[model samples]
Target chain A: MNLNIEVNNNVLTAMPGDTILDALNRHGMNVPTLCHLKGLMPSGACRMCVVEVEGRKNLVTSCSEPVMDGMKIQTHSARVIESRKTIVELLLSNHPDDCLYCERNGSCELQKLAEDLNVRERRISGNKNNYKLDVSSASIVRDPAKCILCGRCVRVCEEIEGVSAIEFVGRGSKTFIDTSFNHGLNVSTCVNCGQCIMVCPTGALKEKPHIDEIKTKLADPTKTVVIQYAPSITISLAEEFGFKPGQNIGGIMNAALRRIGFNFVFDTSFSADLTIMEEASELVHRITTGGTLPMITSCCPGWVKYAEEFQHDILPNLSSCKSPQQMMGAIIKSYFAEAEGINPADIYSVSVMPCTAKKFEQQREEMTQNGISDVDAVLTTRELARLIRLFGIDMDKISPELADSPLGTRSSAGKIFGVSGGVMEAAIRSAHYFITGKELIKFQVNAVRGLAGRKEAKVMINGLEIGVAVVSGLKNAEILMEEVRNGRKDIHFIEVMACPGGCINGGGQPIGTNEESLRARMKSLYEIDEHDAIKVSHKNPYIIELYDKFLGKPLGHKSHHLLHTNYQERDVN
Target chain B: MKSKVEEILQQYPNAGRDSLIPILQSVQESLGFLSEESVVQVSKFLKMPASKIFGVATFYNQFRFTQPGKYHVMVCRGTACHVLGSATVLEEIEKYLKVKPGMTTKDKIFSLEVVACIGACGLAPVISINGEFHAKVTTESIQSIFETYRNREV
Candidate 1:
């Protein structure tokens, strides 16, 4: 068989069995496609990648076709270009024309395709999309008006996350994506993870805006507005301000938040350290006292909701510690309110997170005391960038500033909670100390680090083997849940995150980012851990002070009242 | 009816994900239409999300959600019937019954549904009521046929 295929007067290497799209893509052909996700099986529903081939009756969809040896292919012939242009025009005809008001106006893939293809006019027209917008969920809004039916969100939700919250409901032209029985998202089995928002090409899916309420709070003179940011947002949010991906802009971010009318700024990672402290002691207590064996970490609100909806039987295995976002929010109202002489009612608590699910988690009935919610509002990384822009805070001109006293300082152990295996590693560090009263020879548990969806490691604390598993993305977590269901007793601890690669690449971070950027963010967290002097959560002075001054100890009564809560089985069926 | 659905699910002991279609078909055959509870039961049995099951079930015309009315009406819209003016017959029935295709009347006595073919080309413009056939129907004669079913006569 011939080894080469002619393309536009140039011979490119074409593997015998590779699809033409793959061959072209591999050899640096930048053919645009709307429905093709790199690793998934191509649906080929959209003909955007269609190419003209010699001796073919119609344009061949490059994504679905296998390359034949010595087959002549033209990726951008006049006919192919016209076909692609027509496809875009048709999609635009049905799409909403309000781009200026759209959430994805600047970053929309369809808008980019329209520009790249030089689509100048409405050459074709069709009935416009008049589907109703679904704003029932607190974390996400689904506007069917702008959906181009790329199926990316549906594919990722079903194939990767294994939560088919949305699906193509009808057939043919009547086809539209909907929840079960075309119901509202709130009643559906959606975990509010916002992975759908990350995959959506248009503004059809977006984080439910908390910006208006935040604006109201920021402008209110009576309310003392205090804000905290998640561990992952520090590194991942830098890219939103045109900084290099994974740049640690934590100090500048604190300064920016202060400029945006927040009276006080705090770091969520401090509470992450607090979470580790409570969670570690809880693990040791459970293991020693013959409580639940495989105690799952509950740092990720998305994973917690998923467990509540799908794996309700194993709710006993979940650690009752509140997530760092809620932890800091609760503390800001309770401990910080008392110390600063501010009433909990007057203090408006806000958190910036790399997750949309944090919005849902903040409003949980358990995360409230005396009708006062811990977190008043939550902003995604993208929304924070929008806020910074709206306030005209020049990130480049801003000087770095430290977070406020008492609730700000954190160890690298808490900071690395941005990554997937971070919680397990942090908890193990404190658990080892809590158990043996000594530090591990090395602070870094390298076995459970990096971008893998799942990782396992064994730890020896005084010759008692402790087996641990860390999984991000509910699909990966499903495997371990099945094992536990089938009575596998060897595993003792589990860490689950709803988004893959952890909060650094969470659904509420920057949209349309590649894997390389995620790797950079992951690498930055590890690097921070590597260079920091305080490697363990137990070593943070503020945490030790917090325990000594206010909360008596881990798993104490006050800690249970403030930092720990129970989860119940949520019926999704 | 819910217990019958559960019993139907139990028959397929090897009921995994792929067995969903057969289970859905069996349940629908016994119950006449798919119910919300049946879909949830199928979800539990197959260990799949109910949304996924609902989605797959809605893709085909063979599966339906609403329960059939006491006297289910089927108007054949096949090529032979359409050529013989079954469209007008369907319109008359819809007009008389005051319900569209796949919907039941408010009183629960009559249901109207359109089918592609009844395989009786010789008896063109045919409609079936509770599996009993009526041949060569028209707009004028349609109201009388429904009156006969309403009166419980042959």
Candidate 2:
């Protein structure tokens, strides 16, 4: 299977499965590539790797073309160079020359490729296709003009995460990646997972800007700016500051927030434990009262948005309890504000999440029950990284500090809520306790753990079998729904998270999370859970105190007024 | 024998506006044309106004609401096909038919349309006449293809 290849007049040896690019790279030839990410397959769309292959009619994209025996490949022949130049020029024709003001100017792959290819001027004079920038979500932006239609976003959504929210619509020059029925991301079945922004080559996808608002708040002497960091953020945030992925910089993160001049620093995990108490009670009540079967977890904002958009018919299946962040927001305004004797309006509750959909979720009119939004502005992990750098905080050199008390002391079940299947496991822990009134000997529910695209498990509770299904990706959710529509076996409960690895790998988290980082982060999450003294949410003293003081109890009249929400059917057409 | 309209209605049980293009395309591919009876069946199955369906079928370039010519000539305008001078081949086809793209000859011998990438970029400048691919096409090749179709008609 050995092949003798002559690329760029230099002889090289290759194997049967080696691509033309692979052979050239082995020979120390540096060819330009943009869409060839290490983990993903080469899409051959950039056309920068064009090479003239002997016996082939035209220049073939070397990244996709396999090496054959005695193949004479010309990597930089006049025709091949011309083809590459033309492709680069065509790409440049639509690209704006606003790199000076761009956030990712020097770091952008597309910008570097244009410079490497020496594209001084665009040969084509076609008008650039213009689109109104979409800043509706907190963590992501959509600038269609900057998009090259390389389909890196679409590929990542489908291949990496198993969600196909964005797809190529129309033909040729008119083609662009759009949500189904050409609707906006807010209206479409988009989970706002922000993975698309991470893989995007240009500024077409970016984190929603909240630095200005934060700066304004920091400048105000009267208003108190409170920031709460999700549990998963600490494990993933270090990667953005050049620390290796899954490096524990929790103390450093707390210090950074303190350095950022926030009036109060809190942890969402405290509210996460509270969410478990409420969600767990709801699950038990449904089981006892013969309510909706397969009650879905509504913690992940992206999954909730997807449920509202495409699965409106199944709204009754969604848990009535608000997400941990929203629950935290509500608690901060009502309980914390009342306890401190401060005006709820003056206290700005900001949640730092590894998700973009939380931004949109916060803006929903229903979320503003107590006159003001429970959560104000939201920031992704990357946005927080940018803010940290702006404040001149050396994240590595800083010492870690503990999160604020009362709302910061959280159980192991609360910490695990950052990862996929964590919500189901947390609910099950509390549900088991609430139903049996005795602690389950085995806390770990192996049935609902892992990164399975579609996972299902059955547990017998009080002689009643409860069927549960976990869906991480929206497309996988679609497949599961299709099965349900086709009269598949009825289930008692389901948990759906939009992101593949759930909130830990949220769209707003730092990119470049490889297999090693994923494994490390997952390990940290389980470690956090196992090392904790309180593994169950129902056992959390703070949650019990909150229920006794303010909310009364789970599904109480006050809890229902502030924490529950209804879904609306979206017009797909 | 069941009318062509009845045959179409049997194929699409729950016809709607969304299925109109696919159904009409399927009917045209099978019967080689849209007949009065088939149109009625489409109207009935889709529960759509016949005039509305007809309007849509005629608007899209892919739809063939009327009868096709004796010869179905599709010149690919895909990126690969265009790079290999399929435009010139199409021009030669127009010269022979004395008509433009998406037109049928008075003699009902030739019809033409430019299709997007047919996924046959390896063999550039491809032309398909009655579902047969003729790769690496030229004016001479197009002329020969037309003559072959004309002879078959005769």
Candidate 3:
């Protein structure tokens, strides 16, 4: 084999160790792929990318085939197209024919492939296998009938999240993805991260939607339905309404929710500020009072559940603060209810979040009070978009509206809770102030700011140099956890977000999201941080006023009762 | 059962991920099948999930998931046996036993398994009761074959 390959009479250079698809892609030629995921080892399970080689008798899967020197390649020859089109038609033969009512009707890769390959006729019709829908998981719903057996969800759950909750069960035509013992996902070691939902190309995996339940609650006049949206939700929700990737649609979202008959709209960033106040105070107290060193952040429910299941020993190292969504829900049920003279039971608290695990997080035992859940319903960012569309509210015509007062205001520190390292940056700002009574000169901590799965930084406050690490993605978190388990010191605080790049890239954010959108969302969050006036959580007036009136101090008795919680080890695995 | 699973895991103290199939086979050999408890212990030892372990176990038809009964039955489904009407003979055993392949009887009296080819095709359409071959099995012969084992004490 030579160093150069001829593709359709054009000479193309092949890099060492480059796959045929990689070389073609580098030369601006694109071949469709179904089971291929970037940054993962190619399994060549799906033959969607078949290319013709000069001397080869049969077509080869370009994703797994290495480029040979002095080779003639035809990417879309007649034979290759026939093979691809036939493959799609065969896959559709057994696939359920319910695209209109399917959750992934618009975004499904299989449907798109059928259209792309012009597979208009059912030349190869076969019997459709009926599969039982698995809706046992709190955060995700699984419809096995719609699955194309691409194995993307299985691979992502195993390679990226390291959860391996689902696997390719059985063999041959009888093969399908299933949990252990075929006993649904609830009994499996699934952490409810929703990452599999994000990677799934079809509607087989989706967030367990609360939109229908939320609509019933909204129509009830006797119930006061108030909604709270996570900090990352505003920027990510724009893409669903034909807006830009990182457009901040908070104001329009507020107006839309109110127009949809929500009694009040609250920003979860307010409680994010509340969380920072308590979490930073807890970190400082741990340092000075000789409490557990290197207190990990418990803001991401996916990470919390992961630690509970996988890292049981590190439970004490986790901060006792509830996540921002749950914290806001707790306050809304307790303080907001009493102040407004409304019964907590009559108030149906709804939260819109970017992460699916927040759905599971809000339903946690400690997230409720007196048999009533703090957050009655949890809608994903995608679900919130569907709700807005269901109401026929045109977001383009809606004007920017402010969040309701008392429990609605927040600082930039609270707003930055959307991105991966945002929690650590916000907490560091407050922890610095809590330790030395002075804020840091630079609010943006550059070391922990990028989309890298893991990052580490250090800060000097009053001659005490403290080390901190920020990690996103459970697989990366597993590596850091190994070091911590092996007795690594010098790191005082660690922040972990289960989804890669944090809430902006959460499982419930949006379908058909790409790398560019993720980067754009992160940029928009930082741009907001760079310009906002109140840059620290302590400076939020609502938080300050709450401390003075409702709560005595951060980590105080009342704050502990409402804003803090504990975690118990789960033996699901 | 947990301690016994622990003992099997102890045999592969320095085992890694690749040792999974061998270890699973060993456990199945001892326990007659891969029990949920054994799967959990193997998962913990390999630092993997039981779901993945189950997937691998189900891929090959060799592994069983249910305990074998006192009289384990194997029916050959090879090309020779299949052409000679083993399908009907197997169906008769399933109907008489009231259990599917890879499943045991409710009373733990019999466990029936369908094998792709046990290489006993010289006497086509064969059935084995406790490794004792009843060559040239017929559909009507299944009842009398089970009656022979049903009346016998362990």
TM-score of each: 0.92, 0.73, 0.97
Q: What are the per-residue Cα lDDT tens digits for candidate 2 across A1-573? A: 578988767778998888888888777787777676655687998888888888889788888989898899887788877777787788878777688987677567778776776777767866776877776545567888788888888777766654455677555676766664344666544567787876787878877777788888888888888998887998899888788776778888888999999878888988888888888888889878988766888888777776776678788888988888888888888889989888999988788998888887888777885579999989888889889889999876888898877887788898888877888888888888888888878888887877666788887766767788888767677678777767775687788888776777787877555556777787788888878889998888888888888999888898898777777765421
Q: Give model 3's TM-score versus the native structure.
A: 0.97
- Pick by TM-score: which candidate is best? 3
Give the TM-score of chain A in candidate 2: 0.87
Chain A TM per candidate, in order of listing: 0.97, 0.87, 0.98
For candidate 1, the per-residue lDDT at A573 reads 52
Residues A1-573, model 1: lDDT tens digits: 546888887998887878889999888887889988877688898889999999998999999899887789999999999999999998998898999999998899999999999998888888889999999988999999898888988988887788899998877776789998788998888888888888888999999899899999899999999999998888888898888987999999999999999999999989999999999999999999999979999989888988998888889999999999988988889989999899999999999998999989988899998999999999999999999999999999989999998899999999999999999999999999999999999888998998888899999999999999999889999988999889988789999999988898788999977788999998999999999999999999999999998999999988999999999889875
Q: Compute the lDDT of residue B76 as modeled in candidate 3.
A: 93
Per residue, candidate 3 scores C-alpha lDDT tens digits across A277-306 of 999999999988999878999999999998
Output the worst ten-in-a-row residue range by lDDT, candidate 3 chain A.
A1-10
Which should have the higher TM-score, number 1 or number 2?
A: 1
lDDT score for residue A567 of model 1: 97
Residue A272 in model 3: shift from native, Å? 0.7
